[model samples]
Target: MNDGGFSALVVLDDLAAPRFSPGAAELLALMDSVADACPLDSAALHAQASAELGLGDFGPRDYEERLEVLLAAYRDAPRLSRAGRVNLHAQFLQLLKNRLLFTDLLRREPGIAGIELAPPVVIAGLPRTGTTHLLQLLAATGRFRTLPYWEGLEPFPLPGEAGVVPEPRRERTQAAVALMNDAMPHFARMHEMADADHVHEEIALLASDFSTMYFETLTEVPAWQEYYAGHDQAPHYRYLRLHLQALQHLRPGPAGAGRWLLKSPQHLEQLPVLAETFPGATVVITHRDPVHVVTSMATMVAYTDRMFSDPTDPAGTGRRWAARIERMLDALQRDRSALPPDRAVDLPFADLMADQLGAVERILAMAGERFDAAARSGAEAYLAGHAAGHLGRVDYRPELVGLDPDDLRRRFASYERRFLPSEEPLPVDN
Candidate 1:
């Protein structure tokens, strides 16, 4: 893949070709051979979760329908390889255990439901549109309650796991992070990640409800996507609020911890739901040229797809993600008015890249939070430690994904006109 005039730093100069390392290949082979042991059957998964957690109640039976539908889709999915099945089964089981743990916690401590939550500040945008970086900067300010990547993996601590030293949850997450980095070294270059304390999207919480775009990230699942699109996600969004409350109750933060800071691309398509779930939230929408978004997203998808499926279809990934972005943009444009004008902030990619602290200050102002000395110090520290492109840079070419820049520009014309700056020059396709 050729660089599309986006980055100059080349820390990984030897990675001219895109292929999985030998270690990764061997690991995938082992996983494929053991695929039969990790069945994708919903019944088997539910039993395993209950057995593991010693909890039987799954909160509500409504989620069962969604789970069944998802499992069926996975079973019938054409492109899902054996390794994909094993990996997805593990993810599915973890979510099942998460659901069980939450239900058990709520049953024991009914007060968790009564815990009031302050309105959150949410960042809504597509991937590669400065969402992750903005989330990190704001989180660094130490003014808002945010979900860590480790907590997102397992929201509820396992039974008898409270007040323990070193935090078992964090240790497990660190191991997982190391394994992923070893398997896909270039991932951090495209999207930076951390072990315990990195800011993560609430999309992980939404996964317990079995209604999120996260599933589609693994491989092509058109039926699951169609099913997800047909349903109203308001209930699931409310479920996400409940998860947040439980998290707050489990680990009580400072007095102002009620005001959560959240970001997720899923929020782009669920603007109305987000507004309903967390009223008076400061909604920040980040804008970038759809061409750049599609190119970078397709490249990341193909790179990660090696762990599950073989013979990456960059062209198909580009087409699917382009359509997905189009739908999210349409939903955003239509329902943006759902949020009050006073609580809305539109941040262009160029502006954020040009002056990150300025963008953070603007967002904090919109959220009615002061950009005081502490906030400034934290933001500056984060900037110094995690400079952009520090991990390295990947040269993403639209042609590698069979994407035509002109066509993408035409397709996203209305969105660009509405949100992006008119004077922003078109990105060159090398």
Candidate 2:
């Protein structure tokens, strides 16, 4: 059941003013010296990944320019702590390594390219719009291939790990999750991260192509953001599809299984590319009040920013995401018609909260999937085990995040009127 703001569970630490543990702070400070020694150089990182993986090819060279642009943006990122720089370097290097592994797999098994993919059920929506819950419920139905968090971290296994029991990828991901929980203790309240087996978006696949909004979560990089905005993402979307094909080829499930179930807030602005990439896909666009979305998003981003930077600015986060979301909405308003009406479903957040199972039924129906007894039972079990707000709560202060409720409502009035009319009272997360 949904916890609509009134929960006896512990309220999480304040995001407006994050308090780091003395031990954690000392560890971070110690890591800074080691991190400062590693610079964010694209060429060096590429060469390192090549040397480590014993692979010379990284698929296509088209992504090199974008990687270069992102590195330069990281160089210009403001107030980026040494630890943050270290994190960025590690992340980029891992992405490069993943690319190498993927390209190598494609090279070894040329037949992988011939593997056909079923039309996926894609969820496109902003953060805080119940997209994660919807994806989890659908995945529980055992009706689609979903990417687990561990797989998202490293899609391909290391050399000599094929056919190995108890994947090392999962164990490594579990360790990373523990470290992240210690660093950002309250993040689970805002976004679920308690388990490595949880469902994750395909944004990581997009990052392999060096074209995604995942970087912004670490810290603001307007230069990279601008570059990302100016590029055509269809090729990257194709790259994502190639990886999906590879994953399916690497691990072929029982014959005649369901389609892939995927979700990403990034797709809210890339509906056209999504449609073009996955023809005949079931596109579900979840809707919520923009004011509430912005406030919640701002708080979460600001909270996560503390891990990478000291003294995060909540107001700046609020303002930046507010504008960023507005641009997404504008793009949605412009490109929504790109999706065929029969294959698209509009899901309001209030309706999802009001009838979670019912929403699943509707979404499944839209995707031409049956809501069998097994599916319902699985979904019910998932809901029972994963109640909202069970991980505690966070006090969302819009004022502290430089958000005015009235002004926000007015700013998003057009979007509200278009998608969530006044008749449907929006549920408040509080």
Ten contiguous residues with the weakest lDDT in model 1: 9-18
lDDT of each: 0.84, 0.84
CA lDDT, candidate 1, residue 385: 80
lDDT of 2: 0.84
- Residue-level lDDT of model 2, residues 127-157, one tens digit each, is 9898888888888888888899999989999
Give the best candidate by TM-score.
Answer: 2
Query: Candidate 2: which pairs clash?
Result: none
The TM-score between candidate 2 and the true structure equals 0.95
TM-score of each: 0.94, 0.95
Instruction: Give the distance in Å from residue 419's predicted Cα in candidate 1 to where it truly belongs.
Output: 1.0
